[model samples]
Target: MNLKFIEKILIVMFLLTFGIIWYDFYTFSQPQLNMNPDLSYSRLLEYIKMGWVKQVDLYRNNRLAIIEASSPDLGDRSQLFRVNIPIAASQLIQKLKEYDINFDAHPIPQKNIFIKIAYNLLIPFIFITSLIYFFQSSNNIPGFPNLPGGPGAFFMNLGKSPAKLTESTDDTSFDDVKGIEEVKEEVEEIVSFLVDQDKYTLVGATIPKGVLLVGPPGTGKTLLAKAIANEAKVPFYNAAGGEFIELFVGIGASRMRDLFVQANKNSPCIVFIDEIDAIARKRGGGYGSTNDEREQTLNQLLSELDGFKENSGVILVGATNRVDILDSALLRPGRFDRIIDVPLPTRLGRSEILKLYAKKLSLDETVSLLDIADKTAGFSGAELANLLNESAILSARYKSEKITKKEINEAFERVIGGIAGLAMESGKIKTLIAYHEIGHALIGSILKNHDNVEKITLIPRGEAKGLTWFKSRGDARLFTRAQLTSRIITLYGGRAAETIIFGKPEVTTGASNDIERVTEIAYKMVTVYGMSSLGPRAFIKLNKTRQFPYPPKPMMSVKTRIKVSREVHRLLKGYEKIANRIIFENRIIIDLLVEKLLEIETLESSDFYNLLNQYIILPSK
Candidate 1:
């Protein structure tokens, strides 16, 4: 169960083994000789009558005897022999006493000092330790219980829920969380309902049975749930969805029932289940399904949520990144009525988060939170926190007392890609990558609709040989067809530059990721976004209820599919031509950017744009 308990058990076993070994040695050490049955009893009487017997040691309640006799071969030397006393041998001890023969009625010692210590001291010590372990285990100290044999034999309370009942403390409040204001506001209203239900009840409004926090991973969903509990000053019951499902059947359902019962007992409380997708996957299983336990658990959860009344005061909050795989019933009107989308933070939110993390760090006066936030466009809250921590680690590594802007930027790159290591050293491959990345940057800078070229680097990061990042000059909610085409053209710039500089035959597979992004955007534009010749209606549905479910018997005919393919192909070719033209016209600028990148390995937004402005002439739009 615990280290101390296990140590005590081992000690007890060791003492027992030692005692057994001692007893075996003691028994084996007793000197005895075998004698014929009649001769043994008759010789004992003969020796007693002849006065040759020196001493007789009687054991086994005096039924057996070790006889010490004088040996004639060695004149007066004594020898030892054993004999079993017969029923008529009752007179043997009396005859020995009448003859005045030396005799001892010593019982062979059952326990010596060691055995006595083991039995009296070690056994009692182990018993006390066992009692302590049992009581500690009964209180659930996060380990297997040492119940007699092992944990496997102790499954009496296996059906009990593993959720911990915790009362929220005032330490973690809304002020601690910096970004995602909209998410905070929504959860804050839930806290209001929890704290003062009468305010909502006057309008005949009922609090939602469950609130589902759906977002990508690392978006601080669980933090918001804790904030709600803290604000409401209610009991918080925490459990992961995986904890409900077990290998045995019906265990999951039993746990679900137990959790609800406990939550109901602690009314005016919040039950937060993180990663609910583990048990709440879509119901209908096909041929090779082995999720019977999980399905039963989900069914129980659905039943609990459906059966809840307004003033029951037990709110269920579930967080998941994979809501698409969840059962539709879980997202219906009554259960999980509020589906809050906790999207990634914006630029302002990132700035706030950076500043909040930087408050504890000794940052240099030159460090600007706004500059760091501007470069980290798509970073989540967790990534941002990790970025600051990495910056501090770098600072410590360099023996600096404070974090500088340079260290923060390096850490940012490490977080986005990976730590800088041995890249291709000024070889043909390095030059090729430099040109490829510069091509993307040049195209982005020249195209008005495209985002501003953020950073261009020849240094390898992640799976790419080189990377060219673009940042939105302004946060535009909608993208026009022109803007999408400009992005596709920019994506093609890498391949186009390779073909232009190193001949068409020498173009490598380095543009695979770029091609993938371009294809996805093109496909989405045609079928889903309705941005192509296929017309204004969406030809493909998202269908979040099921994963890769069959299409509803082809909404469009074969001709429509052909049309969509043709449109996608046309957009790709058209963008390729535009990229080729841009690269050809700005060949000097592209070459200059590549040369600079090869020298420095990385160029920030200001450096890249300044060099681009020197060679490229802009059209006054």
Candidate 2:
């Protein structure tokens, strides 16, 4: 819950308590008379002219009003009024002596308003307190709405772990997760351990104390962890890293203690944390503020992990894509013990994921899963799943019962960052884009080392106004230096083709991404792979480098960094000049290809190869 809602509920409780206390006070103050109705004092006084029924006190402020009655029957009920009313003994005795009813009012002198406040508002204050206690006691209630989006500013623990309850409501299992056979086999080892702890224990080997599931988000890291518990028929306690921390200084540490205590009781179970980075981040990296709750939470977690013996039945499982960002202390040899790397799904894995999500879809004859897997070379398991789901939506939108290849292609475009909207393109611009794409395909055809360009389309996907897709015969792997350079030349081929044909630069800055791709290749070739004639020394890493690869120490002088940058620009310029020459000599092919693109806005790889038939003869040795 959020702070706003909590405040509202508190206000409501205060008002309710005040109302109940006031009602009780009025009830106790109702007038009662001891005289018989026929011999009433008011009636006798009326004959003598004192007629008003004034000051009928059921309660005295500090003491009971001691009326010197002719009758002697009121003493038994006297103590009851003393306890209920604000009352003193001396004041009652004085009233009887003077016969003036000088009873002390609860003497709430301006000096002692605190006492009167306690007496008058005690019931409401107690009522408000009990309500607060009731909410605190029911901390485990799940799925409570927080006031929109603050920390658990709502009631306690409501939004914390939708994980445990989702087990009953969420029917997903291991079959839904795809890829990484090695990692799945590793997780199953833990499952086998949980199934029969005695089998491993008899040999003096306690089951591995903890298993950390590490991978990129949407790669089924947490899903695989949950499936292990579901398959074992064991309980699961799931929480986010952030959920354990709160604003109260040591509240996070307290909650960690509580979580582990409860988790240990349900032994032979799995405790999974999604996004462990929030709690397990390398400490002392954050600002050195005194009230750093996340650091304290991490400290408590380290304590809990250390507290567990090898024989302890509880298993700790954590998932995070940014394994590098995690603290080395938390991932030390004995604590996390095993760090399983979950990678993106392979083609076969994608096929399986597609089939699973497509179980509810009506697939047409041409909607081949293998073809999709081949086309989607770089998609992760999650992307493929999303592709299938989007295809189903497209089929429904078009009012087709069966999902078709066309719809699947459209869905692929959406998954790939969606089509560049129509408002962003014009007819002449479309023709230019089509020809520019064709230029890349033509160059790809002539260059024996280039991967086969698959499809060239003016209909954009992602932010690009046009795209040229290429496919190699096999699975995607790290690109070789030669392959990387060839790819960059092909990227620049579009803009290069425009200049060679139109005798001017007709292409737009859509080639900005193309130039960026080219620059990286040049940088990598020179700095990382030692592919350049410049030899293998670089001032920066290609992986981290916006400038170069095989990064050198940053302690180097600024002049060295600038020189390395100059070398990168020089390398890109060399490739661009050579690529321009290649397109210049083959201007006829570029022209014909553009004519064909103007006629047809999109063309497949076969169409490209067919048009460049004359230029396709084997390159002379």
Candidate 3:
């Protein structure tokens, strides 16, 4: 039933309950006074004899009487009183006749048949129906699977696996994916295994039971799993790790077993678990630290992978951003033998991804996918897709016939900087921001290792009052010490410029983010990259509390810590000096760029390059 109808039923039931209570209170509200046997019999006689008794209701098998009387002391006022009759008063009917008092007798009341039926049956039925409807219409209870239908269906599905099984006939396949060539190659073997399992068995080569797809989020791990299933033309079962767990402890284990059984029935099938870290977290966490349900579920999953007859034609594929936290037992050779790392796409890969998304859009021929790829160096496949989607939104908003290159770039800006037209500040703040951004752009233009400054804007975006974006020439896999140092110098350029223009004390907190990035890079160089005098060892300790990959903290003595701190300081100070020198030498150019920035609010790479060409010779690395 619809919620509105159920609600009306509930309201009617509530009103009925209230009306019954009120009617019951009003009907059974008669007042009575009690008197002992001797006194009651004497008063009864006196009232009847004096003709003051109007009527008497004999109850309790004639042993009790409710007398409606008018006594001398009561002065014609009718009073309702109860009196207990002695068994010796056998002539009570005769006494009533002699005293001329009207009398009646009644047995205890039996409830009305309709009220009895309503109380014993109808109310409970309504209550149960309403409860079932409530559970059905409301959102899923925490830790419960979102089972469709009513309460019966919910309870019926409670024990069943939450994994969603799909046939390979569905549309997603290798063609739907792009940018991850190596990942596709890694999983292609699984498809071959599923397509012809007997061929592998005849050659005495066993198929890998599990393929662990590890990467940062939005790198297409789940999509790759689906594509593998589609290519293999096998039944595919997809489930998140969290869905296996519930408020009940053993339910997760039960679910894992059920999922395996189903996959086994549909042999040559693929089972994909997204975010496996939810259940596959390392076992033996400290006392009271590990979740029993999750641990049990993980144990069951391990069993299903390599416990018995090797699961025959079942291929298990798991994906997680944090592979570090997974149980080592699950990662061992037999379980997840092939560990496929899906890193962020390279420049060419990003270009491919853009092309894939662009095919659906009415993109202009003038719009260069290669250019957009260069601008989005660190973007993942999913991010690129979202960028295209946002661009389409912008196109629709402007009522444009085709998605222009300008819309694509604006979409990029919106994704990185929240909303457009948000940066509307003016005057001194604007001038300071202009100088800061121009300083970075000028230094980047002068440096050979640094990427070309793509665009500089004095208008605020995100948390900054200005921004200087550098478009990558290509995806550089390795960074030299000179390149890292150049990056540090570029970071300091903004603060250095502010210090030169407004003096040391007047530098704004806008450079705090820059300082943070610089500190991280410096720390990584010394401890992780081992570029410092400290040694070619990673002395930093990884965080044990979390599974998300983060830079390790240094595990060192106080004296060594002080030494590392000194080195990092020296690096930052030296870079700052380089930045200051650059700013000091290009003071006039900085003023001109700031003026141009203030007037236009934004400058493209060509604008900055033209001005740089007029004043300075480009340096060689």
Name every residue pair that clashes in candidate 3. none
Determine the C-alpha RMSD for candidate 2 after optimal superposition of all C-alphas: 12.6
User: By lDDT, who's the top model here?
Assistant: 3
Q: Please provide, for model 1 over 1-621, each residue's C-alpha lDDT reduced to its tens digit, 9 standing for 90 to 100.
A: 575757667676777867766775666455445542323788788888888889888877787788888756438777777877876667887899899999988666565676667677776676776655544444332432322323322465567776777798658788877779988888899989998999899999989899999887888888888888988999998889988777887988998998899899899999999999998999876323348888989999999998887768999999998888899999997999899998878889989888888889999999989888877877788889999999999999999999998799789878877866676888888898888888898888788888887788777777877888787654455789888888899999999999899989889999998899998789778887888776877767765532233644335689988888899899898889889988888887788888888889989989987877777675432
Instruction: Give the poorly placed runs of model 1, Cα more than 4 Å off.
Output: 1-154, 286-290, 543-559, 619-621
The positional error of residue 355 in candidate 1, measured at the CA in angstroms, is 2.6
Query: What is candidate 2's lDDT per residue for 134-169, written digit by digit as tens?
Result: 554423333433222223334344323333423323
Error of 2 at 86 (Å): 37
Give the winner by TM-score: 1 or 2: 1
* Candidate lDDT values, in order: 0.81, 0.67, 0.83
Residues forming the 10-long window of minimal summed lDDT in candidate 1: 144-153
Q: List model 3 lDDT by residue over 414-504, tens digit each.
A: 8887665566567787788888898888888888988888889866666766788888777887898888988989999999999999999
Clashes of each: 0, 17, 0
Tell me how many residue pairs clash in candidate 2.
17
